[model samples]
Target: MFLKPLLHDFRLALIQLHVSAVKSENLQRACGLVREASAKGAEVVALPECFNSPYGTQYFKEYAEKIPGESTQKLSEVAKECGIYLVGGSIPEEDGGKLYNTCAVFGPDGAMLAKHRKVHLFDINVPGKIQFRESETLSPGNSFSMFDTPYCKVGLGICYDIRFAEMAQVYGQKGCQLLIYPGAFNLTTGPAHWELLQRGRAVDNQVYIAAVSPARDEKASYVAWGHSTVVNP
Candidate 1:
């Protein structure tokens, strides 16, 4: 009798978390979401950018923490307990007095798989509407990053980073089957460009793209257009 190769199916949970000024509440909410996803048999859970804090650059100084800080520590523990891969969304990280918008990925074993900082900062200043200067508060990530999972090779990209095609092309060249982007785009661009850019990247790279955004916070300092979605190439 001949034996056949075995194949496995992978399930991903995209968490569109609503961010707030309270850190403890945000973390608790994320942990809860991870637990829920795990209960649903999700092998991997991807979260929205800045899931532990607000999205604006102005709040970077106040919320930034180190890699092994409280947020990552809590997320790692949750991943270990739930036995699911957790993409601990983007957060403000403090390094040598400079801040970085970074994403940390944890394995089911509660190990730090990979970390990718936002390279392409949002430095656009739209006249009479919105102005963003990420460089002013956060240092840009110098290198591209990807990690291996039981399901497939995964690539990481943040909000503004998705607009750059080079990053996705690099991931495609590396044989990544899925690219995850945790973003919180503003109304000025989110309404018109969010989905378009995500789909474009997915089609161009021929890979699945999962983009999660924080639910709209109209009363916050910056309002985000919430429409978290997943796209397949």
Candidate 2:
């Protein structure tokens, strides 16, 4: 295991956000939550996957934004205002005419620390239950993302990427003390494997694992499992 003998302690906060179809409202709510978390002494705060817009292939093109676009601009401003590290969660990113599920991290001074495009595309057909394919509208990211903080080294991933244990092992080998995944697991797969996968990764890597998800929205087309959790090895 890659357990560290000693490391600086830091408080982490996960925002189980209620996502909406409205982009501006989503950003406002997320920023408010980050400020609240920072006020409560959280050194690092995370938002949920697809926190800025509704989670669906149909909405990808409508909500997709460039890296330095409006969504990321709000994230940077909030991080600097709160004086805390902020994980901007997964947004539909538009780069070179292709869309990707991406996560951006910012430091206390609001510098862009690292950006991770989700490596694994969630393409599962559970027959009678649910059928979804991200590849239809989104492209996969190729690189593993890691960044250094005063508290620890952080590794990033998104929703379906958590299922690959090998990715967690690589992060651990690279000395990542904490792994953060902003995910949006639907009702079908969430109850069965969400927490289980997080626990498995944390134990195997001997690192803190934070799996964040958007709050369950019953009225929406895609209902997410609302448990945003942190697991300790």
Candidate 3:
């Protein structure tokens, strides 16, 4: 449904980034896209999951970095430059010898507002289809992430976290008006529940939902189902 924009509305832009193996190139491309989106009047911009690296369990450690490392530093610079609330999509984060899928948020002043690790790891096996195990290389986060903007209160999550309705409910109960999830659903589950899950969460919470995803790359090791979407209440 087309929810009409309010007089004091904010424009949210989702970048369906095409991830590559080259970490530097991916970061550069993502910053450029954020700039372009901001120039076009996006006050809040979000990137796709693992925009700085290809999606897969094997590649997590290779591309993982500290929070204040290279990737988030760029995100901070760009957010300040554009004067926008920037959601630096999910990345492979290395902390305490454990790797976690984490999403970082930055304010217009370049201050990081929140760091949400993927609370639920995506581990599923479907016979004759897709079998993936994130828990093999990644650890789960124990908290929910939320922040505030001039326009509304925002809740944050990574890909797999959207599947759990209870978490979204908690965010809703905590007075979040919008929920953002940077996801990279695979070919097997993307078509099946990607949009469905987002809609379900939005309806259940009575809020808006933005589920951003990486653009599909045919040559990537693990293909991502790229249908970045937003659902209104």
> What are the lDDT scores of the predictions, listed in order?
0.88, 0.94, 0.93
Give the winner by TM-score: 1 or 3.
3
- As for candidate 3, its clashing pairs are none
Off by over 4 Å in 1: 1-7
Positional deviation of residue 145's Cα in model 1 after best superposition, in angstroms: 0.9
Error of 3 at 124 (Å): 0.9
Each candidate's TM vs. the true structure? 0.95, 0.98, 0.96
Write down the worst ten-residue block by lDDT for model 1. 1-10
Report the C-alpha lDDT of model 1 over 1-233, residue by residue, as the tens digit: 12122135688899987888999999999999899999999998988899988878779889999999999999999999999889888899998888999999999999999999998998988899898888888889998889898678889999999999999989888878788999989989998899999999888878888988888988988787889888878
In candidate 2, stretches whose alpha carbon ends up further than 4 angstroms from where it belongs are none
Residues 1-233, model 3: lDDT tens digits: 23334336899999998888999999999999999999999999999888899889999999999999999999999999999999999899999999999999999999999999999999999999989999999999999899999888899989999999999999988888889999999999999999999999988778899999999988988889999999988
Clashing residue pair totals per candidate (backbone < 3 A): 0, 0, 0
Question: Model 1 lDDT vs. the true structure?
Answer: 0.88
TM-score of 3: 0.96
lDDT of 2 at 65: 97
Rank ordering of all candidates by TM-score, starting from the highest: 2, 3, 1
